[model samples]
Target: MPRITYIEHDGTEHTVEVGNGLSVMEGARDNDIPGIEADCGGACACATCHVYVDPSWIGKIPAKDDAEADMLDFAAAPTSGASRLACQIRVGDHLDGLIVRMPETQG
Candidate 1:
């Protein structure tokens, strides 16, 4: 299992253990993490699952694809090098301790 660290806007943190093959968005939604809206249900059609990849973990994650890259353009918090859609990150043994900070808003 992979444990993900979710940090809310006010600095509240929740760690959830997720199994392999489940996406980060799924992990958040299943555990009821406050900030992950996941409105499009991991479809990549909505940026509701938007998150900021903690800089320290940036290099460890894979690069985004074209579709995910385009969806991020509409994210409310402004896209930067760390911006990513949670639906794209899958839980894996190597992803243990993955840390992601939620945005102030989804839309």
Candidate 2:
């Protein structure tokens, strides 16, 4: 398991141990965390699971694919180079200390 920290727009934080191989969106969804909406249920068809990767960990995570990048355009919140769809990121030992922040809203 890897411990991932999800920070809400209002600054609330939830750190939990996520099972290896699960998507980051699953980590938040399974834990009842308030921020990630996951409307498409990890299909990568919706940007509701959007989150901004913490600055330090930005380059460490895998790069986004075309589908993820395309859907992010529909996110209700603004995005930056750090913007990513949680469903596209899988949890693994390499991401044990990963941190992601939720935007103010989701699409």
Best by lDDT: 2
Q: TM-score of model 2 relative to the true fold?
A: 0.97
Q: What is the lDDT of candidate 2?
A: 0.93
Residue runs of model 1 more than 4 Å from their true location after superposition: none
Candidate 2 weakest ten by summed lDDT:
72-81
lDDT of 1 by residue, 1-107 (tens): 88999999899999989889999999999998999899899999999999999999989999999999999999987567899999999889989999999999988
Give candidate 2 misplaced runs (Cα > 4 Å): none
- Give the TM-score comparing model 1 with the true structure, all chains together: 0.97
Residue 97 local lDDT, model 2: 96
lDDT of 1 at 25: 96
lDDT of 2 by residue, 1-107 (tens): 79999999999999999999999999999999998999889999889999999999989999998999999999877567899999999999999999999999886
Each model's backbone clash number: 0, 0
